[model samples]
Target: MAREPLHLLKTVYGYDAFRGRQAEIIDHAIAGGNAFVLMPTGGGKSLCYQIPALCRPGMGLVVSPLIALMADQVAALRQAGVKAAALNSSLAPQERTAIWQAMEKGALDLLYVAPETLLRPAFLERLRAMRLSLIAIDEAHCLSQWGHDFRPEYRRLDCLADLFPDTPRMALTATADAPTRAEIVSHLKIGVENSFIAGFDRPNIRYAIAEKDAPRRQMLAFLEAHKGDSGIIYCLSKRKTEETAAFLNERGYTALAYHAGLDKAVRDANQTRFQREDGLVMVATIAFGMGIDKPDVRFVLHLDLPGSIEAYYQETGRAGRDGLPADALMLYGYEDIALRQRFIDESDAPEQRKRMERQKLDALLGLTETGQCRRQVLLNYFGESHAPCGNCDNCATPPEMFDGSIAAQKALSCIYRTGERFGQAYIVSVLLGAEDERISRFGHDRLSTYGIGKEHDARTWRSILRQLVAHGLVNVDLAGHGGLSISERGRDFLREKPALMLRIPARTGGRPAKAAPHEVARGIAPADRALFEALREKRLSIARAQNLPPYVIFHDKTLVEMAVVRPRDRRALEAISGVGHSKLERYGAAFLDVIARHSP
Candidate 1:
C-alpha cells in the first residue's frame, strides 16, 4: 500500500504536523499545482518539496547553485534512509553512470542537479523520458538580474517550464524582494495566487550593530562573549578577511580565513573545518556563503558594512539555521561607508544600476544609524509588517536621544553659509573651526556659523550630517565632486525648525556582558537547560562516532522539544517533531534512556 504524504510526514520525517505553508505546498505539488514560495530562512522550506517527492510518482528533481549545498542536503536525506543521489561535475564519469542506473532502475527517490547540468540537452532529453514527480528550483532569487547572487545559468531555468509543462514546478528563495519575486514568478510561469509569502522575522536571532570604535577591540570583546561557539565574521575584502582571521587565531579563537583569493584547496579545507568542527569561526568575504547549510552556527558578526540590505539580510540569515537562539552583530564606521561609496562610483555598471545600488546602500546605512527598533526596519524592507521586536539591541537598550531641532538648524545654516559647495567634512571643519588650508583658502573661517557649532565635536556633527542625508534634508552629490547640497527639505527645515531627535548608542569602556547563549533561550523553561545540555552532549557523542556534524543527527529545535516534552519512550519520541522512523529506531531509545536517567 502506498503511504500518504501525511503518513510520510509522521513515519518518515516524524513530524506530527505541517508548519507555515508546508502542508498546503506539499498537497498542491502532490496534486500537481505550481507555486512560488517566499519563506524565511530556517523556516523549513525544504519540507514543501521533500514530502511531495515521497508521495508522488517518479523522481523529484531539485535544481540548485552550489555543489556543497547539494552535497550537504543529500547527506542529510540519505541519513534519513531515503534513496537520494547527486549527479554533478565533481562525480567521476563512472560514478555518474551509477546514478544513471539508479534513475533508470527507479531506485532513486530524489535527484539533485545543478542548473548547468540540467540545461544540457542530453540530460534534458533523458529527463523527458523519466516520469518526473516535480521540479524545484532552490534559492530561486538567483534567477533575477537584480539579485546580488544572480547567476547566468539560473536564467536558463525557464527551459524547465517548456520541457515539463505539466509537472508541478516550484521556485523557492529566502531573499527575494518584490521585483525579484515578480521576476521569479514570471520566469517560472507560476501564478501569484500560488505564491506563499511567509513572515520574514527570525525572532530567535538578537540583532545588534555598533559604530566601529576601536574595531579590533570591539570585535574581540564581542567574540569573547560567544567563546567556543560556531560563528562567521564577514569582511568586505579578501586581505581584511585573512587579517581578521589571523588576529582572532592569535587571540586564542579557532579561526580560519576563506576568500576567493585563497587557493582552491585552502578554501575547501577551511569550509570543511567550519562545517564539521564545533567551535571554529570562519572569517570570510561575500564569496564564502551562498548556500551554507550548517544549522548550529550561533552567531554572524560583520567586521565591515554589507553592500545592500538584501545582502545583509541573506548573510545574517545563515546563522542559527537550527531555530536555536542566535546573535548577529555588525560593526560599521564612516570609513566603511566611504569605501562602499567608492566601490559604487568606480563600478563600470550602468548608471541606473549604480543609482539603485546607492539607494540600497543608503537603506542599509539608515538601518545601522536608526534610533528606532531594528527588526521593524529590517522586516519592513521585505514588505513584512512586524511590531518592535523586543529582542533586538534597539528595543533592549533603546538608544538615548536629545532634541536636535536647534542643532539641526545650526548644521543646515553651516552648510548654506559655506555655499553648499563643500562636503560634510569641510562644512563640519568650518563649523568646528578646524583652520584647514581649504577652509582658510575659501575664507570660510570668517563665516557666522564658522565657530558657532564648536560646542559639538567632529564625530557628533558627522552623525548629524548622516541623519540629515538619511532623512533627505541633505544630498551628497556623488557625481559633482561629492559636495553637500541642500534639498528642498533642508530649506523647509530652515524655514520651520521642526522637532528633530538624534539617537546615541551606548558605548562602554569594556564589553559589558552581551547576550549570552543561555540568556538568548527566552522561551525555554529554566528547568530544561540541563536536559538540553545533556541532549547536546548525547548528539555530540553520536556525531563524533559517525564523523558528521552534530546537526546532521538532529537539530537543536528537535532537542529543545524533547527537553520540553520529556518523551519517555520510542512512541513518545516519534511524537516529537524531527524524529523520523529511521532516526527514532537509531537514537530514540538512547535518548529515552538519557531522559529517564534525568527524570525524577
Candidate 2:
C-alpha cells in the first residue's frame, strides 16, 4: 500500500513524522472532514490544516483573528514554496485586489483572511467564486464566551462555514478546556465525531510558582540568571508592561513592551523586532500571545497571576517550541487573588459566568500554593496524571521546613490578642511586641504571647503567615474582609498541637551566572561560528525581504544543523532535519554557496 499523502507532506515539511494525533487530524481534514483541534501551543497544530491544504484541490481559507498571524502564516507558506497570500485590513487596496486576482486565477494555494473581512458581503462574494479546499479557524478558543480573548465576531464564523459547506473546516487553538471545546463545536457547528483533542502535556516546559516578594528584583534576578536567552515577561496591566520593559532595557537587556495601548505600527515593529532579533525579550500583557510564532523562547515569567489556568497554560506554552527545555515561572501574591476576585465581582457577567471565573481563579491559586510537584498539580488540573517533575524550584531547591508549631501558636495568640480583626501587619507587630502607635492603639503590647516570636525577624514571621494560609491552616476573610482568620484546620491545630514546616523564601537581589551558555554553543565549531552568523544574517535578510518570520525561513536548529553538516549539495542538505524538498529547492543554493565559499 502507498504511504498516505499526509505522511508525504510531513516529509516535505521537514518533520520526520506527525506527533500525537496530527496524522489522524490531517487525514480527516484531507477527506473533507470538519474538525475541532485542541492542541497546545508547541504542538504541531498548524500542520493539521497546512498539510491537508496542500493535498486538496484548491486554495485553503485560513480565518485568523490577527493581521500579524495571517501575514506570518502566508509568508511562511510562500517561503516553503507553497503559493499563499493574505487579505487583511493592513493590506493596501492594490494588495487586496492582487490577492483577489491571484485567488481567481488559481495562482495561490492558500488564502488567509481576517474573520471580519470574511463577514463582509463583498469579500464573501469574491470567495464564493474561488474553490476553497479548506477553512481553517486559528485561535478557535476565541469563539467561546468563556475564553479569555473572546471576540464577538467569531460567532459570525458559522455563516462562512455554512456558505462553504462542502469545504472541510478545521478550527485550531493552542489551549481549550472542556467547556471551551464544547463552545467551539457548537459555535462553529462542527460535528462531535470530528473533534480532536491532542494531549495537553508540554513536558518540555517546567512549571514553578514563587510567592511574590520584591517582584521587580526577582524578575531582574531571573533575567540575569537566564541572560541572552529568549523569553517573555507577562504583566497584568499595560503600565507594568511598559515599566518592566523599560527596567529590563535600562539593565542592558534587549526588551520591548507590547500592549494594546501602543500604536498599531509600534506594536507591529516591536513584534517584528522580537521575532527577528535573537535573544529579544518581550514584556507584554495577555493581548500579546495570540499571534506570536517565535519558537525558541527559553522561559515565560508571569509577574502577576493569570486570570485562569487555561490562559496561563496557553501563554506559557509559547516557550520551548523546539521541544527543548523551558521554564514557566510565576509570582503570586495576596494582591493578585484580590485583584482577580474584584474583577469577577465587578464584572457584568451572569451568575454562572462569575462562578466559573472564580473556579478558574481558585485553580490558579491552587497551582501557586501547592507544595506538591508543580507539573503534577498542573497536569492534575487538566485531568492528566504524572509523576513529580524533579526539575522545578520546589523540587530542586526544596524549602527548609521546620516544626512551626510554637511559631503558629504564638502567631495565633497574637491574632487573638488583637481581636482577630487586624491584618498581617498588626498581627506581626503584636507578635514582635512592638510599641508602635498601632500596637499601642490596639493595646496588643500587653498580650501574654506578645514578644514571644521576637527571635524571628519580621520578614520571617510574614513568610510563616503566607505559608499558613497556603497550607489551609488559616484563611483571609474576604467577607470580614481582607483580614486574617483561623480556618477549621487552624482550630484543629490549636486544639491538637498541629505541626508546621515552612520554606524560607529565597532572597532575591544579586545575579547568578545564567544557565550554562555553553549548552547552546556546544555543537557549533569554532571555525563555523562566523559562518553560522552569516547564515543567520542571510536568513534574516530573506525574512525581511519577504516580510516573513525569520524562523519560517530557517529555524535556529536548522541553521545549527547546517553549520555542523556543511552540506555541499541539495542531497546532503536534504538529510538535515527541518530541511525538506520544498525548503531545499527554495533556499538550498544560497546556503550551499555560503558553505562553499567558507569551506577550507
Candidate 3:
C-alpha cells in the first residue's frame, strides 16, 4: 500500500494531515495490531479510530459509555458521508433491529454500542459473525477501579477482544495518570509495547485557582469578564447546579441546569441546545454528562472542588476543544476538602479504594495551594514536564510572600488555646479577638494571644488559616468532630524554620472589557465588515458541502487573514496559513468567487 494514498484521503477529508500519533495508531490498527492510546481531550484521539475505520475493510466497533456521545459522533461521521450508526437503549426496537441487520449486511462502516449491549451473549455472538476491522475503547480509563469514574461494565470488555483475537483493538481516554494507566493495561490484558501515550498538555487552556472568597461574587466577576461566550459551570452538588443556573439566568444570560435528577429527555434537550446554539451556559454536576463533543466552550468554572485532579482536568478539557484560547477557573476553600473527605468516608468502597481516592484528593488540593505555575502542575500530573506557562493566574500575577513565622505561631497558639475544637470561622474570630458567644462560652477571651492579631482584618486571618492547611501545618479532622488540629509539620515549623514564606491571595475586583464584536472588522467600515461576513459564510457553506470541519476548510484565523489581505486568487489563497496546494485546487474557485462578489 502507498503512503501517498493516505495523504490524498487526508486532503479529501480537508485535514492537513494526521495530528500527533494519529497516523501511527491508525497504521497499527489497519495492520491488525492492538493499541492502548492515552490521549487527552482535543488531542485528536478520534482520528486514530476514524481514519482506520475509513481505510480498512468491515465495520469498526466503538464501545462508548454515553448515549449522547454515540449520537454526536455518529452525526458527525454521517455529515462527513461515513456510514455510521449507533445501537443503544435510546433506539427503537425496529431501528435497533435494522441497525444490526445493516451491520450484518456490511452496510454500516462503523457501529457504536453501549458496554451493556456489548456484554450480551447474543450480541457478542452476532459481533463474532461480522467482520470487525477494529475495536476502539473510548473513555478507557473507566476500566480501572482506581479511575475516578469506574464502571463495572468496562471491565467485562476485555472478553470482546478475547473472543476476537484476530482483530486489532485500541483503547483511548482523556485523563489517566501513571497508576491508572498501569491498571488499564493489566485489566484489559494489553501489552506495554502496544500503548501510545500522547503528550497531555492543553496549551490553549489558561489555568487559574482563586481562593474561595464570596464564591458567588467571584463567579459573577469571571462571567462578566467573559460575557456572551459559551462555558460550563461545574458544581459539586445538584442543588448548587440548579441555583447557579438560576442565578445566571436571572442575570440576563442563557443558562440551563442539568443533572441526573432531571428527566432524561430534558437533559438531552439542554445538552443539544448548548452544543448547537451560541453563548449558552450549562450548569451541571458530575452526574449530568461527560464526553460532550462541544468544540467552542470558552471556559470551565468549578464553583466547588472536584474529588480529584483527573476529574478536574477532564471537565476543564471540555473547554477550548477547537484549539482556541480558553480559561479554567477553580474556586477552592478549606470547606471543600472537608466535603470531599466526608463523602469519601461514607462511600462503600474498600480500604484500598478509599486510600486511592484520598491520594487523588490530595493531588487536587495541592494544585490549589501551590504557588507554582498552574499549567505546569496540571501537565506534570499527567507525566509531562513543562516550564511555567506564564499564562495562568500565578504566572501572570506572582504572589507577594511574607515571613509568617510569628503569624503562624499566633494562629497555632489560638487553635491550642481553643482546645483545637474550632473550625476556620471561629478560629478567625478568636485570632481577631472578636467577642462572640462561642468564644465567651469557651473562655477564649482570656487567652494571651487574644487581640494579639487585631490589627489584621478577617480576610488576612482567613488567608493565614488557609496557608496553614496548605502547608500541612494543620489538618482538618474529617473523622472527628471536624475541627482544625496542629500537625507535626506545624511543630517543626515552629521549632526549626521560624521564617516561612506565605503567599497573599490575589485580590479580586474589576470589570473586564467586553469581548469585541464577532464581526471580523471590529473597527473597520461597515462595507468591509459585510465583506468579511460574506466571505466567512461562503467558506462555511463550502466546508459543509465538502463534509469537513469548518476550521479544516479554512481556520477562523485564515478567514481573518483573508479579510486583511483580500486574497484575490488561488495563488494568494495558497499562501494563507491553512490553505495548501491541494486546498487551493479543491476550494479556491468557491472562495475566490465570494471575494470577487464582495470586493469593492
**Model 2 CA deviation exceeding 4 Å by range:** 1-12, 400-423, 452-456, 468-519, 522-531, 545-547, 596-600
Against the true structure, what is every candidate's RMSD? 3.5, 3.6, 4.2
lDDT of 3 at 491: 75
lDDT of each: 0.84, 0.80, 0.78
Residue 103 C-alpha lDDT in model 3: 90
Winner by lDDT: 1
- TM per candidate comes to 0.89, 0.89, 0.87
Return model 3's CA RMSD, one decimal.
4.2
lDDT per residue for candidate 1 within 165-243, as digits (tens), equals: 9889989988888889999999888988889887788998989988765679888777777887889999999999999
Q: Model 2 reaches what TM-score against the true structure?
A: 0.89
Model 2: per-residue Cα lDDT over 1-600, one tens digit each: 113664555456666767889888888888889999988777889888888888888888888998877777776776666788888887888987888888888888778888898899988887898898899999998888888989999988989667998998889987787778888888788878888878688877767777777788778766765677788999999999999999888989989999999998999899988877778999999889878778878889999989998899889988888777777888876656666777898899999999999788778777776567877888787777888778666666555566788888888767766777778877887778777887776666677877888888888888778767755566666666578777787888889985676666555421211232322445677987877878888888877887666788887778888887799888888888788778888788998898888888
- Worst ten-residue run, lDDT, model 3? 509-518
Off by over 4 Å in 3: 1-5, 8-12, 435-441, 475-483, 487-500, 509-598
